[model samples]
Structure formats: structure tokens, C-alpha cells
Target chain A: MEKNQILSVAISGLLALGLAGTANAADNKPEMEKCFGIAKAGMNDCSGSKSSHSCAGQASKNNDPMDFVAVPKGTCNKIANGSLTDGGGVVKKAM
Target chain B: MPASKYTFPCVAGIGLRAPHYREVLETLPELGWVEVHSENFFGGGAPLHTLRKVREHYPVSLHGVGMGLASATPLDEKHLSDLSQLCNDIQPVAVSEHLCWNAATGFVINDLLPFPYTREALDHVTRRVTQVQEKLKRQLLVENLSSYISFSQSEMTEGDFLAELTQRSGCGILFDVENLYVNVRNLGVDAEAFIKTIPADAVKEYHLAGFSERDGCLVDTHNHPVYNEVWDLYEHVLKHLGPRPTLIEWDTDIPALPELLNEAAKAQLIIEQCHD
Candidate 1:
């Protein structure tokens, strides 16, 4: 009886280890989120902005600040015309 | 019969995030090329308009993240058609997608999930790859994916499967060196041996990105800069496999244009030195 119990416990432990190993494999999500947060902070810091900014509208080449529907009053033209705030290094259009 | 015209310049390119669209076009950062996710710009209006403008300035490449080609469920024809349309509109230098599957019939996980890699799976993937290539009318660059689990059902190694796919479908391989490194640290894969198995000529592009350590394994999280070891392996591959069009990918915590370009420039310099 004692021997059987010991064998069962050992088997269970091995199974647990295998399951854990599989779960902790190559997941890119958590680190990717962390990197994105850091990049956002880096962009804000580099461009001297206090609040978050969206690149989808302002980064457009047309530079018609009016073309973007939700341009923040202070931030849009405040960023130079050809000087874009996004990471792709595109220059904004002139005001 | 210009082979190089179908190819990209042997220079550094940036992942064209929406943030720097105007700045990039107006100033024309001396970049070799630019790449954007096809799904992100699938919808018209602003995204398409911006991509069109950027396309004018730089040689763009379309990279797809959510094809789920090896899924147990059927292929997403809508997604494939969208990609085909984008390819036609953009006329990108290259088009690529991840190797792992994501959509199961009932449930669709947005993450790139690995499978058993059995003969059955290979047959499924090969068929899907052929379908995608035929639909697009261009050779698709299939990237190797990073995985967290290994199924006992696997009959072949990932390298062998990829080699077979290349041979059967006439597809180009986008060897993500970072992914191979992560697999080695996490799953005891022999990176050098894996490299040896692949047909060097079939490999048209190389991907370098950063990964973070998880428990005892490493995950291919594209949030950080290219690590030293990955760079070293890339150098080795370039020397042995020969210089291919290399991309510096940072999907998460993406830095500023200059910072990202700097990373790309580092890769570009290494790539240039390898050929010399």
C-alpha cells in the first residue's frame, strides 16, 4: 500500500511539471504590451506632450488639420506641419 | 528578366506606423523601404488614404498577422480577398504572413497559436499556402512562428515542415531569427541544426526582433531592440545562408522614427558588412 501511494504521488508530480512547462512556453503578449507602453511614453517624452496623442489622423500627409475629424484644439498644428509625431519618421505637411 | 526589380533594396526600412506618416513623406527619411500590417489598412478612408501617400515615397511591403492558415477551420476567404485587394492597391515589393494558425472553427484566438505539426497539419497548410499564393498571384513569404507548447502528435520538425512547404508550394521563407532563438531557449531546439535544414536559397528575407524571458523559456515579444545573441546568430546566418533582405520589427513599445530607424540602421550595417 505504501509503495503504491508513493508511486502515485511521483506520477502526479511529473504530470504537474509537464503541464507547467507547456503553459510557460513562448508567449509574446505581456512583453509586447510592456514595450508598447514604454514606446508611447518615449514618444510623449520626445515630443514634449503631456497627454496621449493619436497618430491615425495627424500623421496624414495632407496636413489639412481639418481632414482629421477629432483633432485636439491645441495639439494638431502645435506639432510642426511636416513634423509628424509617429514613429515612422514621416515629416508633417506645412500649415 | 530583372531579378532585383522584384526584390527590395539592400537597405534599412521602417515599419510604417500611422504616427509618422506625414513626416516620412515630406522629409523622406533616407529609409530603404517601409512595411505595414495589411489588416490595419484593410478599411478604406483614412488608413488607405495614408498608405497610398506613403506608398508614393517608399517601397512598401505588406505583412499579415492573422491569416490562421493552419487552423482546423476553413480558411477565411474574406481575409484572403482583403489581402489580395490590398496587394493590388499597394503593389508592395513583398507580401508575408505568419506560419502558425489562429482560427479554430468555433473559437478564433487572435494570437498566433502552434499546432501538433503532424503530416495532417502539413497537408492542410500546404493546401492553404497554395490557395493564398494563387489568389494573390505572387509568392508569399511565410514566417516561422514562436510557440509555447509542443504537441506529442508532431511527426516532423518545424524546419522540415517549412522546407516541404517551400518545395511544394513554391513559397519564399521569411526566417525570423528571433523566433528560432526563442524556441531554442524555451524548447531545446537546435538552432544551428534547424538553419542547416532550410534551403538557403528559398529564404528571401530575415526578421530580427526582441524577446522577453518567461519562466524558463523566452517569448518572441517584438517590444525590445534586437538582442546581442540574435544579432550574432543573424551574422552567422548571413555568412552561411548569405545576406537576405533583413527587417527590424518592433510591434510593441515601438520607439520614435529615428530610434526605430537607428535599430534598422544597425541591422543594415551588419547586413552590408556580411556581403563585404
Candidate 2:
């Protein structure tokens, strides 16, 4: 019921929600958003394909390669070869 | 909180990254101090939890990667508040951020980008620095950033800008030697002139990191070992600026803890020589 404590709680909630909003604002940026969307779609299209490298490689060329923060080439190779599969599900391949 | 509890050893330190965190905590290796990216610990999770444990053994410095001080955009109150909260929680020995911008008019680069060092830019940056210091209620050590490009409109050099900011805002300096070296080679910035301009007394800490060559420019990657040339420059700085709490920062392609400690040990040797 203290004024300062109430103010602190309100501020904390704002910051927590602000982070998600910031991320959304970041997504609204044209090049970054377009690249990420193309890359995500490319990932989905080639999600479980054993030859995901060809798709990923093409997608990476068309999409924003910098979006994923340096994906190991080995992981991409594994995804392409189907060795990186999960149990009865596929982790979408992205760089 | 007794400030002495987080007393920084007047020697060299290294950046504490995830790869080397466990070994550092488990072994409790002899390090003068350690710096971590402030943004990483903004959210209360495993990373922030780990920082609390690390703080117990080593004198921790929170180095921020974001909070674009020189950006034309309005200051991010949320980011500053988060940083302030973290500082309160950890009670770090030192807190630092770079003199670069990430956000602009409706655009966020997410990487540190250089702007024209014009008078307008200087005014913008100085105001932001004051706001940050006032919000934190602590003297922030602003680190110089490395840039790949330069603007023709630049009036004052980055060093001079920092000097003026320090004079105006009463903030301390966290001079990154690698960034200065990178600027010298890439932007044809006069490193010696930079050293001359900055107020030596304002400098509270030094950062030594590695730069990688990219397209005829040195990038502040901090992924490789400290270069021989940068070490020489650090010695030059130590000689003129006098010994300050130094740190070895390696962010990308981070090696083992011993390797980082080895780098810090190299800096320590220089610090010792400076003292003698």
C-alpha cells in the first residue's frame, strides 16, 4: 500500500513488457524483418528434408545470414544429411 | 554494501564469458578482475544467477554492449533502468558501455555503428552520457568504440568528444586499447593525438582485446589473442596514462579459462612494469 513500492511494481511491469515490444519494433525494421521472415519460411520449407543444406544454402543466400548469429557450418551439414533429426519431430533448420 | 568487498586488484583481468564461466567459478583462478556483457544478465535467469556466484570470487565489472549513447534516438529509459537495477543487485566494481550507437530513426542496427563526430553529435552524446550517469547514480566508464567508416562531417575526434563528455558529466573513462588501435588503422585516426587529449585522471580502467582484419580494416572482434602491436600500444598507454585496472576481453570464439587467464597474466606483467 506504500506509494514508492507501487511505483516500483508499475515500473518493473513496464520494463518486462518493453523488452517484447522492442523485439517487435526490431522485427518491423524492413531489411531485418524481411530477411528473418524469408529465412524462417525457408527453414520451414526445408525443415525435415535430409538435403536441407541445398535449401538452407540457397535460403542463406537469399535470406539474412547474419540474423542467426553465426550458425556452425557443421550443424547445417548435419541438417542436410538428416543426422540432426529429433525424436518424431524436426527442429526447423536455420542459420 | 562495503565497497571494499568488491575491491579490484590493481592488476590485469579478463572478460568472463559463458565458455570459461564454470572453470573460473570452480577453480577460482587468480584474476585481478572480470568483465561481463551487461545485456546478457539483464533478465533474471541462469546467466544472472551465475553472475551472482562469480561476483563472490572475482571483482566483477558490468560492461554493456547496448544503450546506444551517441544515437540520435531518444534514450532507452527501460535499458537504463535495467542496468541500474543490475548494478544495485551485483554491486559491480566498475560499470562501462561503448561510445557508439545501435538505434537510429526507426532503425536498430543491433551492432555498434559509427556516426559523424559533428558538434550536433557531440551535444547529443554529452546529454545522453549525463542522463545515464544521473540515472545510475554512479560514475560510468565510457569505452571508445572501433568503427569501419568515418563521416566527412566529423568536427571533433572521438577522444576529444570523450574528454569533453568527462569534463561536463564528471564520468570516468574505460579506454579500450583495441578500439583505439582499430580506429587508427581503419579511420586514419591519430592514436597519439587521442592519448594526448583524454584526461589521464578520468581514466579508471583499461580494456585490452584483439582485432581481426576485415576488408583492409581492423574489426574489434575480440575473438583472437591479443596482438603484439596492441600490446605495444597498451604499454605506451600504461606508460603515459599510468597503471589502471586492466581487462583482457575475448567475446567471440572464446577459448578456455586458462587461455583467457594467460592473456590477463600478460596484461598484469605490463601493469607491474608500469607500477615499477
The runs of at least 3 residues in candidate 2 whose Cα sits more than 4 Å from the true structure, single-residue gaps closed, are A1-95, B1-3
- The i-RMS of candidate 2 is 14.5
State the TM-score for model 1: 0.73
TM-scores of all predicted structures: 0.73, 0.75
Against the native complex, each candidate's DockQ, computed on alpha carbons, is 0.01, 0.03
Q: Please write out the lDDT profile of model 2 over residues B1-276, one tens digit for every residue.
A: 123547766788778766566566667787767888888778675567778888887779988878998887899999999999999999999888878888978998676777887878878888988899889898888988788888888888888889988998888999988888888888888989999998999999998877677547576777789899999999998888899989887766667777888888888888888888
**Candidate 1 CAPRI level:** incorrect
Residue B124 CA displacement from its true place in model 1, Å:
0.8
The candidate that achieves the highest TM-score relative to the unseen native structure: 2
Can you write out model 1's per-residue Cα lDDT over B1-276, one digit (the tens) per residue?
Answer: 112333577666767665566557657777778888788778576567767877777788888887887988888999999999999998999899888887876898776778887888889999999999999999999988787678888998999999999999999998988888888877788998889989998998888888776556676667788999999998988887888777887665667778888898898899889868
Instruction: Give candidate 1 misplaced runs (Cα > 4 Å).
Output: A1-95, B1-6
Error of 2 at A58 (Å): 21
TM-score of predicted chain B versus true chain B for each candidate = 0.95, 0.96
